[model samples]
Target: MPQRLELAPPAFNRRKILIHTAAAGALAAGVGVPRWARAQSGPMRIVVGYPPGGGTDRAARLVADRLQQLLKRTVIVENRVGAGGRLAAQQLVNTPPDQTVLLLANPAVMSVSPLIYKDLKYDVQKDYVPVAAVTDYDFGVAVGSALPVKEVQHMLAWIRANPTKANAGVPGTGSLPHFFSLMLSYMAQVNIEVVGYRGSAPLITDLIGGQIPLAFDTLDSLLPQHEGGKLRILATSGLKRSPFSPTVPTFKEQGLPLSAVGWNTFFAPSTTPRATVELLSKAVFQIMSEPETRAKFTAAKMVPVAMTQAQTEASFKAFNTQWTPVIRRSGFKPES
Candidate 1:
């Protein structure tokens, strides 16, 4: 009887058992694999803070459309409009760590709003991570047919001469246009009233109708009218001349010593895995780098930009450092 063959059951080591159990639990929660890998089953969403047909919305749609083709998955743009993009940002912050949702944010929501809104729901630095910057745009000093000016210097002189009519309409208060207008007036030693409108549409209407002598808005907002002869863009706020309107000199070129540029950037919740962010960043860079995409953005008056994740983060931090104190000193408060 081979008694030795009937060996006792193998010893059960507690440590080995526990280790195996923990690893099994981790894998059950989908922890070992990246969240984005598991997220591929669901449709990806790009949240736009603004309404449809707006610049931010358009940029989101462009990225969404191409990303769908590249990934062979469904992509949609969700316009979570309100509070000048604050609501959408807050919503994003509250969302659990997910790779399927992203936000298309503007400079106002990222740089200026946080500085001004004391009760803002989300902290731009802590709540979100920059994925990529899709488009870069400049502000334009546009004048209606009423103002007889062809250049920024001439426009400043006219504002100085006509003190009663020294007013500049802005798309919104606490916007780049509003701050830039104030900076322009201060640098040029003029007293131009900064008027805030509901949005670019109304401000542009006033400009075209000659109700407002001059307006400060995005180049894309004013470029069509500027080209249509409904208004004249005296100067653009860029370090260099815009390719869309190359003849138009920049504020720096015109000796104003000032320039401000804005961008539409994609951001994800801070908890999102780095691998997920890299995946989306690579897709955006590829789409924006394409010649056809560049042409489309150019036609829409937005300059296509293909910045890496690190570059996008650097640009965002730089803007916050550069503009926060300036905004504080300006004493311009948003109308809550």
Candidate 2:
């Protein structure tokens, strides 16, 4: 896995502030700044924290396609997969700020990585700037259809009854899946063991193979299997029933309203220009609003959402505060 992006303080705006003190002063600067300087000149690489074949990767590809068209430049997605997505986050923050690289930015790196690693090389708040982000479906908790369990209560009963055989698989130890599964254990009042995999792909594989009978992961990963009759969804981790599966129950329906939607977002290096971020964000939202894009994401059990850079940043801030107490109590601490 790539390391998390190291945080560098935002460049002081004093210079730009002074230069744009008045409309005439701003006009002088605006006229002098070349169109080429304002426009992105090269290919834009959309980096993902995980490898291809999963939700983040697939969504990145979707956004990449639209970005390429909208920007009139090549848009590429590269998977940096590792260290709970810290690798990709770190890579983006370290890249030059020429609007050349962006991240498919997973919570594993942005929200959770800061809570887990002792020395997370990057500071999500300071080192990376949101470009655009999607609030995809929440992680779903399910069991093999072969299991007798049907709901959260039943699953808890089954786990408690067959303590030896009951276990759940998550994407990675400190990733969002792991955090949610851990929360499930707390809610269920049982010590269901959590097993981590390289990514959602292998985790789903083991799930179907029955190497693991229970698991909690992104709906993007479990949708195909669940819909195909490979696994039975016990409870979706999201607060509401996903539009993709009206029949599937949510943790909230079962009376656990604490669960909320998860997200996969994109961000640029901290040094990247604000204008570039706005352009990228606009392109992403435009793509997400398209029926084809929404349909495709719905099919994958991942919802298509697009938020402006400021909106994305605000959302992340709220999520950070929302989960802080819960995570801190779990004995996890942010990197110093």
Candidate 3:
């Protein structure tokens, strides 16, 4: 019989062909790319504007801890507290994009501060890129022991009756809380005397300890005192009641439909690579969606408001646009 012939994958020639094909695919992906790319290789830093133990600092730390493990890198939160978180924010802009420097800041740092500080060194929108919004710092209107008001309805009535006794403490001279207290008064048709303190910490301490009769403060910062029975929650600043504390109704529930409070978000230097920005955003959404992250935020009384990149950008622009008129109306004159 004639010699039988069989066909199979080529021994050495076929192996080279396979290798070349794989290399081609990887080239389409990126250089140094494996079938499954490893995480970024470097120590990472998340910069926070405030000192440790405060709500903003605490929130930033929470994210840093989970993200360090998620990205398989060393993540440290550097406390750059000063000028109401301005120093930390400015630092992010100046840092090299490749360093992975990020600002885990609240909305005030992004929105309100610039309006008040006439020559703010940094323009949050122009200087920084939006990473991912963590959540809103939900607030509540509560009276201290020094005041004789408890329920939202009673507080409204008292404000109308004793206009002079309606002095309330806000975070600072031109803070969101300041405008918020003013807006609340406008909606309630009452004259509210706003008193400014250095920061939310002192304002909150006074409110609970009865030095100030009323205040508008972050829910995360105020929940502990409310739970400790040091203050009485008159109304939550949310449009609707929070599931965390169902007993305390929302402002709308008390017939104050104007929703005014503070919020927080994450940002990166505008110069950061798009790949890095997208990577950070993807990580943020994943972390926020995690069960443990949700649980921690819920316990802290933070109300999450997830936004797509486009949406957050539009929102930032809208906030910047709208807040100008609002600031002018609030009797704020930016220093010359």
Candidate 4:
């Protein structure tokens, strides 16, 4: 059983004591006490699967800072970086259902890892419950200045014209960008090679230096360079244009049958009580709905989109269903 804190003491007297006793009896019968009435009080943690400074980490910190104010508890962000977020996810799975710990995760860890990893320790569906949807970001395809292509059609044509220089850089192997690149090639009828890097820094470094002609990564990471003319954004991997780069067209608009939108979401251990989940979900929705919060995320190149708990679960289910087939078709296998 989870520990509970007494918020206040009842006044000592026969009449007051009778009222307190009656209230206790009702709570014991599971009648009138609200779910949050038993909420645990302590320092809360928001775990990030990746190291600090990445988009997910930044978002986690942003939420943690606001959550502290909303919940009136000390909220901390913990980084358990490894295995592409699997390590941090497993940690959350093993934690007690006290609702004091949550994982700030992305689709890469929740939806993609299950499809790719053969020896994952925790089951995403069975071990975790969706709490809230945080932010949605689209991937952008950019070409270095050295590359002559300025649009999707031009880039595809350039790939056909110069087959040897048709390789694209992805931030990591088996990542959304990696598979999106594969889908792009499949749809465009072009054979562009994929080269995976440790993270976006090195990938963007080589991209600007002409080491790689094309790169695919989150719009947040690539939009700055695109604005500075260091590179050209051909298309974004969203059904609609990104608010941060509204001038850029989506792959679908550019005639490619591909769209990849990723999100940052909150999750708690599956065993957590429904009331606890609802409490946290409502808190997150309130935080994300604030105009200041929305502006902060927007300035960070992330779109703030809050969803109800049911909607969050439905979105996760829909995303998982949509990506499973795509992952299988990619024929990607993790290294032992």
lDDT of model number 4: 0.77
Residues 1-336 of candidate 4: C-alpha lDDT, one tens digit per residue? 112221112111122222233234323221233445345666788999888988789899888998777676788899999987889998777677655788889988898888888889999979999998887778889999679777798888888888887889999888888887766776567787899999899999999999999998888888888899888889998677877888999887877666667788999988877887887787777667666876788787667766667767877776766566667777899775
Q: What overall lDDT, based on C-alpha atoms, would model 2 receive against the true structure?
A: 0.68
How many clashes show up in model 1?
A: 0
TM-score: the better of candidates 2 and 3: 3
TM per model? 0.83, 0.76, 0.79, 0.84
lDDT by residue (tens digit), candidate 2, 27-81: 2221223365437677778888886887678888877886676566777788887
User: Candidate 3, residues 179-200: lDDT per residue as tens digits?
Assistant: 7676666556677788888777
Tell me the whole-model lDDT of each prediction, alpha carbons only: 0.77, 0.68, 0.68, 0.77
Q: What TM-score, to 2 decimals, does candidate 2 have?
A: 0.76
Which should have the higher TM-score, number 3 or number 4? 4
> Largest TM-score belongs to which candidate?
4
| TM-score (C-alpha) between model 1 and the true structure | 0.83
